[model samples]
Target: MDQAPGSPQGPQDAPSLPKCYRHPDRDTGISCTRCERPICTECMISASVGFQCPECVRTGSGTGHAPDANRPRTIAGGSITDDSFLVTKILIGINVAVFVMVLALGERFLAETELIGYAYSPQLSEIVGVAHGQWYRLVTAVFLHQELPHILFNMLGLWFLGRIVEPALGRSRFIAVYLLSGLGGSALAYLLAAPNQPSLGASGAIFGLMGAFAVLARRTNIDMRPVLIILAVSLVLTFTRPDISWEGHIGGLVAGALITLGLVYAPRDRRTLVQLATCAAVLLLILATVVGRTVSLT
Candidate 1:
């Protein structure tokens, strides 16, 4: 029975009991933590850790009140947050922003005619002339898309893949995958491209996402046949499409898959860190070799 508010003794003096969410008559005094509403004995629900009001409990809702519901989830060696969905948005924003910059600065004239010196190159010999000397392009070039359709497709792939991958891998791991894939792609291009030819696109990074997905699917209980089919189709489109870099795509795919494999098979969080370190080490070695060759050629 609920004590009248005016009772001199207060809650301490009354017989404490649970109440239903709807009932104003009988005092059943139990409350649900989730909704913070009252519930009576007949309507009260015992959750994993506590009692919940009928509405919040949803008896047949198939919701097994997980004891860890109130606790945080750490999955794939990273903090799990609802905001993981937003990582895709951020990547979209970056690609769009870079495209806008390309547009604002003017197209062919700014991209091809005006040269940025700090491009990445796989060939040490190319570094001697402005034609291929800008090694920094290896990193920056990945962001440079010459056409709208190019950026559009790349962004689409990133948005789709990132939404799925980021949540599974966490923010840091996703970021690492993107950067390393792009770099690896660029490195491969540098080594393979004709000294004077300039290459740029987010294709490498997007391919990385595909590779990561493949690894993730294989490691987890997911059926990967559909994903594999999609990947194969993407490769076909890549080659048939004019101005696309097949080499970059292949390089990024290999790098992403290898990185993903390491992360998935590793013992624990240590694997995630180890994958990151391996990528870093390989990239550094490539950079050093490229830069050294460039200096010698110059």
Candidate 2:
């Protein structure tokens, strides 16, 4: 089995502003305080601390009884779904399913999915890795976990962080942060770790969430002490713990912070464009890193 893939032995794994709800053609970061939905400056009804959507202003209050067309939105302009944590839950399910498969299918299963720059796979009598054009491994490895504890910790962390981060950033923005963070982690590991060293896990994505949550908390003026303590410990573990991919963790942290910074702080005037540019730039950076590393290894 690919037991400790990213270690000396193992592998581990790890958008846009929204359009204005009423005027979908427009893009704005300023959401209605009452409806919590995106609204253009024209639709903004000045209220305390923030603006209210036209409907909320007309209604005189948010009754939470708006029709489905008037679904509430998140602070980041994502529609507030029935379950704010839907995406988070789905991610956990995916990780768990992949973990179960890894257990059932054994090392070959892991070798096929885990992030490796370039490595030989004995089971298939062939070389396999991102360098070999198996770039999907960069993503698959993130959901692949061979050990129980690894998945457990990651899932728990996802739930804990998702509850807050997902709702605030909205579902689409949340997904963007997560996926880019995971890729950043994988790309960094590919660049820095040994070519043949395989690693896989959700740690990168989780760390990304940690970085994001920190930013969100700060933006909302929530006490930072609690998040800081947790982050401090995680950082300590990333460095001190053996078999943990510190490169992936750090990459994720940086990616998450950068991505979320754009999402939250972007000017309402051009929030969508800025956010799209941020994601594109970060993805290009990661891809460039991977390409350079692959060239050197080959």
Candidate 3:
């Protein structure tokens, strides 16, 4: 099974094999038909001529969608995917994976990731948090969950709400909304919560999905009672529950609603630009606030 580096007589030595562009660890001869990037079997997309990468098939030049009608689209002018729940599933997997990592690595990992403007960590034996320029905590904490019940509740909400929102807004916009909501939640906690008070969870992001679902339900004539009822209950709990980050939850809800409003109401002729601009503006505002808070803390 093994061969010398310069034996000049094995498949492993074949010049045809090249490392996949997306996953560089593996070698693949097959390339994307559209982008011509080296792609492994996992990343290949079957096309009329040859296999293409997922990116090329999704938003880039399509394989054989000559007719506009055949090329179905999402409400936000994105290509409709065959699996509406793929993004949601992926999000859950990521959260679970991170949770497993935290379990394996112990409190050190959790201390490093949990959102805090400035909190001294007993595990780390020093001052740790966003104010010390560990800005990635804002993002990592969104997916980090210390308790089983916390993740299960948020993932359940994500599963139901994501199924509703992702299909309506398309994968790109749905994820954009989801991430923005998470960041909005983190930013608010950083700005308003005690600097030493660390908080972490997907609640901010899930609240965002719920908010987006409500917006889409109204626009598409779906029943809004389910979302409203759940949202009301969740908010009540957020305010009453001990150790909960209320600021993050409220921020995510507001951000999700604002982003979805732009998505579902953009003019058809310029939907893409408006959507991009809207997400960008919200992201900039979030960043500006975070910067201001960081400056204040530091």
Candidate 4:
């Protein structure tokens, strides 16, 4: 119980200082709040509860911790994954599948699938209306292309534009824009082209994506020269080429631009609501145009 002067004390007689786990030689009074490992100030990161070691911070990040605003975020506010372009892939798949079906089923099938009759053709009587109520032709025609070259060009456009636009707009909004733009094209063709003329292909939707891309670029204040050039070339092709559906291209461009305008310009406080309303209104306008054309033809 008694010690002589200058004699070493027993282990229990003196308090032990903790050393940093990372730097064993360095004495650190601090311990990680999560892992409880001793860490020096240099190895510690401030956490909500207390200081955490670098290893614990990394581990927590891997386990679903929320990222800061500057990091890339998915539609659900999670980390970006490999399937960011899933919707675009699915659209391309559907278009390819339908083209295959057209090849297998022959000309009759292609004729039936494309948007036809009063709106699409010139010779058909307005009063006759769409045979067997094939109202879906307005949408389905977008996926049907007759020639190899036609499908190739459209799919290439989709692949290029989809990759750029899909990630920016998210899955739902991108798909909505594509489908609605296709419908808008069909409606325009019905109103402008010969009543009996049949039209098919994804050009309308592709053009729509182009338009959306232009709007997005403008919103972000990027250079518009490239977009403007592409658009001008496409418009020239539409007008100069007798076979091209100029009406469809113009309609889709307008529709896509309007929809993207609403999405990009929405107020931060009610972004989702405003975006949905904007897209819905564009779709309704397309539907109304189709109905009005149908009545005129009748």
Worst lDDT run of 10 residues, candidate 4, spans: 70-79
Best by TM-score: 2
Regions of model 1 farther than 4 Å from truth: 1-75, 107-109, 112-133, 292-298
Q: Against the unseen true structure, what C-alpha lDDT does each candidate score?
A: 0.67, 0.83, 0.83, 0.75
Error in Å for residue 147 of model 3? 0.8
Distance from true location, Cα of 291 in model 2, Å: 1.0
For 150-225, candidate 1 gives per-residue lDDT tens digits of 8888988998888777866778778878888887777666666655556788889889989988887665435688
Q: Residue 298 CA error for candidate 3 (Å)?
A: 1.7
TM-score of 2: 0.78
Which candidate, 1 or 4, has the higher TM-score?
4
Model 1: residue 132 alpha-carbon error in angstroms: 6.5
lDDT of 1 at 26: 64
* Ranking of all predicted structures according to lDDT, beginning with the best and ending with the worst: 3, 2, 4, 1
Q: How far is candidate 4 from the true structure (C-alpha RMSD, Å)?
A: 17.7
**What would the per-residue lDDT of candidate 3 be over residues 1-298, giving only the tens digit for each residue?**
6766866585675666689998999988776533446889899875422366777666644555556644545555666566778999999999999999988998889998999899778989999999899999999999999989988998888988887788667788989999999999999999999999999999999888878877866654345787588889999999999989999999899899999999877887897899999999989989999999989988
Candidate 2 Cα outliers beyond 4 Å, as residue runs: 1-72
Q: Whose lDDT is higher: candidate 1's or candidate 2's?
A: 2
TM accuracy, model 1: 0.66
